[model samples]
Target: MAVRGFLRGIGGKNAMPQGASADGSERPLKPIAMGDGATRLQLLDEFEAGGIGWFWATDDQNRLIYLSPAAAANFQVSHEELIGRPLTSLFTLENGEDEEAAERPLPFLISARTKFANMTVKVDAGGDPRWWTISGKPYQDANGVFLGYRGGAKDITADFERQRDNTRAAHFDSLTGLANRNRMTRRLTAILTAYKAAKRSCALLMLDLDRFKAVNDTLGHPAGDELLKQVAQRLERIVGPKGEIGRLGGDEFQVILPDIDDRGDLGELAHRIIQMISQPYSLDGSRAIIGTSVGIAVAPYDGIEPSDLVKSADLALYAAKGGGRGQYRFYSNDLKDSAQQRREIEEDLRDALSRGELRMYYQPVVCSQTHKVKGFEALMRWEHPERGPISPAVFIPIAEDSNLIIALGEWAMRQACEDAAKWPADMTVSVNVSAQQFSTDSLPALVTNALASSGLKPRRLELEITESVFMGDAATTDAMFAKLKKIGVRLALDDFGTGYSSLGYLRKAPFDKIKIDQSFVRGSTEDDNSNSAIIAAIVSLADALDMETTAEGVEAMDELALVKKRGATLIQGFIFSRAVPQEEVLEKLADGNFVYEPNGPEKQRSQRRTLFRRIGVIHEDHRYEAVLRNLSRTGAMIEGLLEVPVGTDLVLDLGEGQLAICRVRRSQDATQGVEFETPLISDGADGLCTRHRISPYALAAAGMPLAALPPGHYAMPDRRGARPTDNRRFMQVDVGMGASRAA
Candidate 1:
């Protein structure tokens, strides 16, 4: 019954109402008339005692004047202790999405002397997690003097937590706990917009697993889900607080790195990501191996908008995968064309062999001590009718992706054996066995047939294989190895010391030689890196295993000397000779010339790339078009500026937001050699670029509307009949001819 009805009945001389006490015993309510002071106080006492709500009052100073005794007990504090405490000491308003609401501090509300209702706040009750919905009203005294708040509060912890959990579920991925696609998209858009205004740089990385589908197909979807979780954890560990990582559906992921544009640092991070992700994984007592390819794009330089930047990165990723798995590539403007070209090559490659456009060339591998030819490695060449010669590095990965490598490998093995049969009796021929070819049960039979058809001795044929062939079932891999060994042919580990090298496999596999990768051989003598030590260790290990070691890519005499001194048994590189046509090799051997003397640069020096492309050269406020003749990490050579003086300062606009400050060190007629003020860093490829660039947003702030970086220098005037304000300092020269001449 309502309190008013109960009170009215009590004073009507009817009957006292029955009520249940705290101990569940029946009790009679004391008779009291409606509007009586005792009745109102008893009503409030019952409300507080029932744990539905609590009353509090504060003085004009906002300090507590009174609080319900039961509320004080809940706080684990005595009523007297809380009597003089500040009202804000017990509760604080939580910040909410709407800033203009009761999210304001409790102190502000009391100070404003305004009524506030149902403001959710955090309850400071002895460190226990609790929330309360509090309502309060400010009052005035009889003399019109201001008074503090009279408030009531009720617990709302459960309700508040449920809302928070729902919000989190909306933004996070339930499987991996990373940000979902929607949240990632929103976050990237917001960040790009804010950073554009701030003129800051951001990098976006797109990653796709190389063989993720294989895992899902073989191990089951549950294991694939588990693998994705592990991948997220590993990425989190590597990225830390540097950026945000998100799973962009399927086996693809993205990362947003703000305020970072240095390609050097980005390349290193990408490399680490590939290496860490490529490591072996264990799932449900089964072992799996997979790799990743990364494509990176920086903001403002690559694109001013989010969609454009994402497209640029995706193209770069496509290029990286096209180059090979387990690699990273930085986005460049030309990648669009490169992507189109890659598709054309893939389409054309399907019928290149049938058209008889493929041929095998051999590069000699010679003894380090005697410099005499011991063997030759078979390399494939594709002479495209319309596109000219194509490098194997470009087409091999394409062939592998299309499942055409098996046919290509079989033909190469047969042709190489046929060619080797005409060579010297003691000379051997090495044919590469791709991972796809080695995985099949027909490889040994294929090898046996090639040897039989060519009438070549079994001992004269060597199958060069990479470490990737080991990424199969251990028993199956061992059986393949045993069959190949039983075929009476030799085996050599190609590109050893690269890619998931393990001594455990080396101990059991029967191999005749180990060919050190070129990456370790280059610059071993030029820098103070540990590459030299690594080379020595590989040779020593090969010697201990009674296997010959060949150092590859030895182009300079200093590198040759170092590798030889390190006890390498053989050498294979440009220092001897690049791969030549099979006919040329046969002709040379027919003349009984089995020795190729070492011929290369006496010393290894910094690599400089030769090119002839138009670039902008700026002096003062004038920009002139020039042809860049060559480029290096430290400097460049340019033509089209006649009689330029030495020590002249100029800026070379290398396009795509790269403005390189440089000084002319050598000037002779139309040729000028310049030294960069700061050394250029790698462009995550075989090129150099400035570490930082001007953002398009900054240009927009300077009167140009925001857009992607346009072609040509920023200060280049319109070439359609634009006049120069001052006389040109240097004369223009025509370098298009074989030589530079006056224009």
Candidate 2:
């Protein structure tokens, strides 16, 4: 069997030729008897055809054989010369006893063959190291024959290099050639787990670029992308060997510093990051500048788990952003509260309109000269069921920023129009329009729909637009105003003196009214030179344009007087009245005797007289029986048991079928104020009074006393005519005496 194996090696092929026998017979080995031998022969032929050389040899005992082209090439010998050489002599062993370390010898045992047993051996050709695979088998005869060793070698250097490149790409950032998020996450997870086990501290710092979008928008995306790459490089330099830096995403990065020395290290890192990122970056021959805000979460203190640490870091990032950019913040509990509050407010604002918690209140705008109600300006108010009343000063800016003002404005228009429908025909209602609301093309449609639904006359509805409304494109403003005017809705320029371009707005827009801002009103009352001049100029401009002027925030009587003197047609302020409920407005309207007195000593006296007269008349009527009282010009007081609510208008019947209309000025217990709506006496009744022999006393007592009495007859003085005590002086003296007695 050994001799046959040696002969097979010398044959230089895996199979015997046809018509030959395996027993050294002249007949060749049959194809059916060749068990893998044919495939091996084909593999060898293909290798040789491809310019690969081969040789075969037997081990020292001549029991096994090895075949391979690589062996001849390594020995720097031709395949024919190496054919029958001893397999052990084909290679040299550095150490005889170090069998495991020795190069895999040829003619190795077949039973020991492994799928991929890699080995390196030095060949005689320049003594170069050659890699190989050695498959070994035990020698046998006939069907059980096994070769000593058989293997094939292929160059794997290029393949190994390609794999190395792929591994690098998978772990590194392509742009900056630094570690990427995946690699960073893996490393960070391992570090965090190890640190937690050992109870050590570490810090995770998150850095985000501020105003980076602005750079991208203004400088183009290429410049922006370049800037990010430069930022990553800077971060890598700053962190150096102390920590690992990674590009988490665009304009965002993360740094992990494991085994921190002290808390100061975190602060130092934060400062370094800020300093490095804040520096200007040059891109495409142009300089670009941006800032970075960093958030740091420390292990064992901020969080124990990786997810918790990341969350805390994110919270800190939010805090850094909140405190303005270009700064760093550490994780803290306060940030959690702030985040929660912001979320809640944002959520509530989104649902505010749907919740139906918003309302509009109308405050009367009175004519400065006539002291008559001219119009009402609708103001929005928000009453949150949970948060109570939120000030307009607080929520208005928020709404504007969030683009919620558009919906709020629409709601206000609809509500104001509905409320205006309930007012007198002549009274107009004005609604404030925000710049955002006016910018919408749907504004006019919204207004038109509101008017149609509320049955409010278009001419009686006014829109108060701020100066900012006209600050945009002139053509747009002109078109908008034209559309609004075409709808027959009056326009008023509100806060006329408060804005920078008020005069410009006024000149461009044809407003029916110009409202002097409250700041001007407040300042004008104090005789502020600039504010007063502004007001005067506005008033003059209004007069020139045939436009009415309204003064807002007229808190003092002097302000009202000044506005009236300045020819302001309307006045709205706390002095006249604060905004009240609809019922209160109706009550004020019914109280025809109600008069506004300016602030002063004499004004107080007159107000007291008015108050006492109203109270006395109503109270006397409630106390005395069969005594009808009418507010006459004289002092006579009549009493009857009746309840007249304050501000109630009623008709009083005097003797001889005379009647007079009066409104309740003051309540009698639960009674209302009264005012004279009509008088019983007419010019034609003079002769009738004289023919009836009725005296002027009854007519005078019924609130119809004339300074120059018309020609009339006399009536019974004691019953029908007013008694002689019905004198103005007597009422004044009685009121004075009653005041003194009460005191």
Candidate 3:
């Protein structure tokens, strides 16, 4: 309507009269009553000069023939300089802020000579970003020959930028500056859908901060927020462009790693994340240390859908935390069962101490030079009435979570002190103190009571504390150390190199010894590893501080020899002795045999996971049931295939879509050892799994509905339409028929 009203002055039918209409009296002229071409041109020039809107025209070649002086000034150039410049060159289609609006490219619209209205575009003025809404129509001569376009445009930069800010705030975490929960979910869903078509893979990682609640409770929520910000920054540095990380609120974070399915690489990255996050954080003049447990799942292998994948990763994360707070686990089908069993374990553990299911075992920490027992580290073990032995690794974290560790730890400490008083006077006992137990004020009083009740000298009761104890409140930690030192009980730093190692704290904390973690000891003998150097540095640091060093988990003579050579003052592992029961400790003390000889394997060998589970053995078209007795990265042992040739190739159907191609390296009667064609990778736990699995999409293409891999064997359907009648060459023996044969 406004344009029509303005156009009336240019000789349109609605033009008003300017003067008297053939009468004596004069008539009032309309505001824009232009009776000549010069007046109409003057009005148009004034409109352009007012910067209300600007006109532009292009020749048939889409080159700018004329632009209003005001609009030309917006580009910071003279109108003459912009003349003959390609109109499309001066303005480009806006980045697709709105998908529908950018569907038609600017060049395509101009070349097609179509009428376009209110198209959002960016003006290529060499300054801050400028956005405009342009409306244009194709013009032509009376003969219908096209003469390009005439358009008017107005700047919308401010409005467009404001809208973009709103979009960003909606999709991103305002505090961490990372994508928020909504954005991460949408991104994961989109990537999985796209990757499903391409048959590619994406790995999802779910991590929950360990002991984060303690930080909040101790230092307040503001400090917790600061700690979270620091954690986000660390994650960004580590993940960078490899993946997208998002905080799912509170202490939970998720990472989406595209094109990454290999568990080995994922495990490495997860370990790095755990290590980096476990380091102490300085927050508002207070120190807070925290750890993370990560769980990983890969697309099509773990699950085909977003929810399933997330659930799988979450299950893995639960397992990691349950195993121990500072670790990572990859998804497996058994985790669901484990998750259920964990809840039961937690319930059972609440009453374990009263039921007498918990007992203390002592592993000897020997003198490296004399091979004599110097002291013993008291370890806790659980023996469920029906389930028998339960690993501390499986139950300790549960106790910590359930707040049973304080009571349980007190019980173990008292028992250790009582038992140590009866042992040879020269020998000492070391009991582990958990971070949860140390955080309470009752620890020092409990230690004092344990010593007084057992009549054991305070020096004989060594309390081993991990690096996590230094998490928050440095002054409090120092006070605790002072109190313990005043009580005359020795303090040994346990798991020294397992992340959170800081020389700054070591300078003041009164520690009597440093226990090198098993992780460093396991690979110290390898020529390619730097574990040896790390061990040397730690031992030297301990020696300089007038402290002793104990190399933990030395199960091989070579590892023991390496640690001893590197000047470790003590050794504690299977190389000397496993943690013995109280009865055995008493029996050994009566015999007066304080010396322990190195009794492990002469050299380190590849660690193989020992288990007895049934799996399928496939030969040609026949699949026979067999027992998988044990498995390693490179090979496995099986039974029930009688007289199979040693060199014959076979496929081992380890269920859940995992198939291992192997050749029988050794065969004898019903027993055979096979070597894998491709060595399996770690399953992020204490097991091996194939790096690649039969995808669920492929299963769907084979007439099965798409879903997460089920617990049964996945075999190719028989396309021959009939079963082959070939007789079996090898007998399927019942290896478990030992009772009948003996009868």
Best by TM-score: 3
Q: Per-residue CA lDDT of candidate 2, range 463-522, in tens?
A: 998765643445777899999999999999887754233355567787999888886766
In model 2, the Cα lDDT at residue 329 comes to: 71
Greater-lDDT candidate between 1 and 3: 3
Global lDDT for candidate 1?
0.86
What does candidate 3 score on TM? 0.91
lDDT of 1 by residue, 551-624 (tens): 99999999999999999999999999999998899888988989999999998777889998999898876788
> Is 2 or 3 the stronger prediction by lDDT?
3
lDDT of 3 by residue, 172-284 (tens): 88889887898889999989998988978899999999999989988899999999999999999999999999998989999999999777789889989998999899998
**TM-score against native, each model:** 0.87, 0.38, 0.91
Candidate 3: worst 10 consecutive residues by lDDT? 734-743
Considering every candidate listed, which one attains the maximal lDDT?
3
lDDT of each: 0.86, 0.62, 0.87
Give the local distance difference test score of model 3. Answer: 0.87
Sorted by TM-score (best first), the order is 3, 1, 2
